[model samples]
Target: MGEARYSRQIPLIGEEGQERLGRSSVAVVGLGGIGSPLSLLVAAAGVGRIRLVDWDLVELSNLNRQILYTSRDLMRPKPFVAAERISLLNPRVEVEVVHEPLVPGNADSIVEGVDLVLDALDSLEARLALGDACQRAGAPHTYAAVQGLFGLVTLIVPGETPCLRCILPERPREEPAFTVGPVPALVASVSASEAIRILSGRGPSLAGRMLVVDLSSPSFEFIELSGECPHRPPEPPPRPAYFRRGDRLYAFEADPSGWERLERRGWAVVEESDAYVRLSGPGSVAVFYSDGGALLVGSRGEGDFREAVGGDLEDL
Candidate 1:
């Protein structure tokens, strides 16, 4: 890599910081509105290794906010397209694209050892899975989400600051699903700054606070959430395919529409909701969410849970 490429910003971060960025690796999950611009910025800034992950094919609707793709790139997988763009942006940078969904089953493999994990994902299920996985492996996770004209950004350091769970305790219902083009672009810029600062050894600026940006009101508010902090889990899960934390047990792979599958299989439903369903199984009560997560309650172990579900983990 040539020093001339980053000559302008070298004065600010110093050559040592630039060298750190060259050696650092990052996993950017969800190459959508936020991920698109964020990837470009991070790459242009000379991040050494960028792991672009997204399984969706580009469509006409994505053209509005996803700057990485154009009309000609439609119907192509995002990771591949992003990889090509990043390679062209910085030929010296090492780019890896994984064309797969980010779920609990594969979260560890994707997020485990990355220098930082950037979340541009829209769904809560993926966020939960990514955050938990990053926390487990002691990886830094940069979380950003857009809601219409507003967006939020926060940097999560395992034992120093608040986590994604602190802000998003439950699922976001509707507003965030749709966003204007500029909202995510702005959010991604902030997120990229956080990632760059951390990679440069300046540490995270938003570690203790959540930045709420409202375009309509034109104000940025820093909400305090510094009191919460937790260290990495002392023990790993029992199996490679599962993520176990406290009473909740997440299968390595699970169908987001698992409740429907359970209903088709004639599993007795103890309770049901739009988000999840509680089903009475052989050894325990199982709760499955609509987006990708499972809870095994009152069960002896994985064996019993697998038997209760009557199939493989992915089949559920």
Candidate 2:
């Protein structure tokens, strides 16, 4: 058993570290491009128990970087496919697959027994929900995202370090349409390496800092997170209307739902004809589309929308 399976990693992580890994539990969310390889590394590394979560089905477009699946596996639920692969890779590693999408309501139970959580999601909404769940669960989470040649890795240790929400108050509104090609491999490799380091209890984890990599530029940079929590005044009880367009553009109001109700009543309407939607309210405005996708205009026509959205955008 020892001759072929883990000889290469033995010297680095050692039998003790391997044993530790075998005893620890890890939960990986989103079994897509980044998640596929990341989960493989964790399972192959001898992680004692692995919990996989994803609601998405495999698609042909994902084969370029999702190493866990092939043409034969297309259309199958990702968590199921990943679990099957992990068992074949190492039966010693117990694999648990949560086939449904993770939401705020079920996040606590999903993360309950895991020592670490890995974010491999494609949408900011899911990431934020996971972050909130991890925080409430007091579990450490490692987040990774890639777009084109750029990738980002961040480690959040609940109250010990800055939470994802603390650093990014608002979720990214728009998703970027990107070409995967070989970028996911690079990002997933780096993210998996970081997870290994965490598992071995070796090296300084990328906690409290965002590790940004640009493969096109072939450059790596670290952005220090502000330790102080940025505080925002509480909105009035009813809450205001807010909608995000594309990755960076956003419109908000003291009452966001009011506009939605008005839209439903046909009192307010946006022509979806031009790839642009009109969001009306205190923050009513028309968002323009760009080559990248929808331009993120924040709070209607405010020039500050661009800067605010640009600064908070995460590429995945």
Candidate 3:
């Protein structure tokens, strides 16, 4: 508890809080602009074990905002250089490097045994996957992104609060992001601070609130995000009842293959052609076609198909 490294903030968080921070393990999933400062801050705060995850290499262009690398480190793998820098900042913190891309097949392994997961990824797909992985692992997740001079940060607590997917239903095509130095630094620090609070048991956690910042105006906006995780495997579309070919139509009574369904249903055959097949039920005329679409013109008391095809009058 006599660590002078955290002396200035020790008064606020206390020795016990510092001990908690020193015992927590956190995984940062991206090592770009946001993850750079975020990992640095978390390590500097003495987070016990830090996992630096990224698949890209450092480039001269990244020097604009990614503070962990220098021009001398160009073309070098990011996670290694990041690990080196973080170690220099605080050797007491244990650092682990994941040098591969985060894919669905390996996301679970990356989050394994971590107390918290931070989302600093640029791609929408990776962000969603990380969120789901954290949810499944029951790890607290912090997500943040920066564009131009604006940035946003949110805290996601697995099944307890709205996840990243709940807020974004579709994955957007990855596009080049426009950002300056200060925006991502601000967002990253905010995310790191939130992680610290949550890990130190000193949080009025941003569990359901998103902090949005517009540094151009030096303004901060708080958005309350609430809901359950709405992510589920999409259901397959239902098979069609009938289909049309040219001006002819065909219907299926059972199996869509050939006309076996109609034969099984005992419907009278009205006509048959290479393009269309027609069937006659007691009071209805059914048309089926090779294209797999079907149409039925039936009586008033029939099934919902009557209303589905715009009712009986239109059928006439």
Question: For candidate 1, lDDT tens digit of each residue in 145-200?
Answer: 98778899988887777667766656657443677888999999999999999998
lDDT for every model? Answer: 0.77, 0.67, 0.74
C-alpha lDDT (0 to 100) for residue 265 of candidate 2: 35
lDDT score, candidate 2, position 6: 81
RMSD of each: 11.0, 12.7, 19.7
lDDT of 1 at 69: 93
Model 3 global lDDT (CA atoms, 0 to 1): 0.74
Q: Which of candidates 1 and 2 is the stronger one according to TM-score?
A: 1
Lowest lDDT 10-residue stretch of candidate 2: 286-295
> Tens digit of lDDT per residue, candidate 2, span 1-316?
2446889987887777767777888999888888998899888888888999875556677887788999996545567779889999988889886755555556667788888898888888667778877877788888888876788888888767788778667766655637464677777777777777887777546888888888787788999875754432222222223444344344332222232333453333443323223343233332222112222222344444333233222210
Where does model 2 exceed 4 Å of error?
A: 1-3, 230-316
For TM-score, candidate 1 versus 3, the one ahead is 1
**Model 1 stretches astray by more than 4 angstroms:** 174-176, 229-316
As a whole number from 0 to 100, the lDDT of residue 239 in candidate 3 is 32
TM-score of each: 0.73, 0.70, 0.72
Give the better candidate number (1 or 2) by lDDT: 1
Clashes of each: 1, 11, 11
Model 3: what TM-score? Answer: 0.72
After TM-score superposition, the amount by which residue 141's alpha carbon in candidate 2 deviates from its true location, in angstroms, is 0.3
Weakest lDDT window of 10 consecutive positions for candidate 3? 242-251
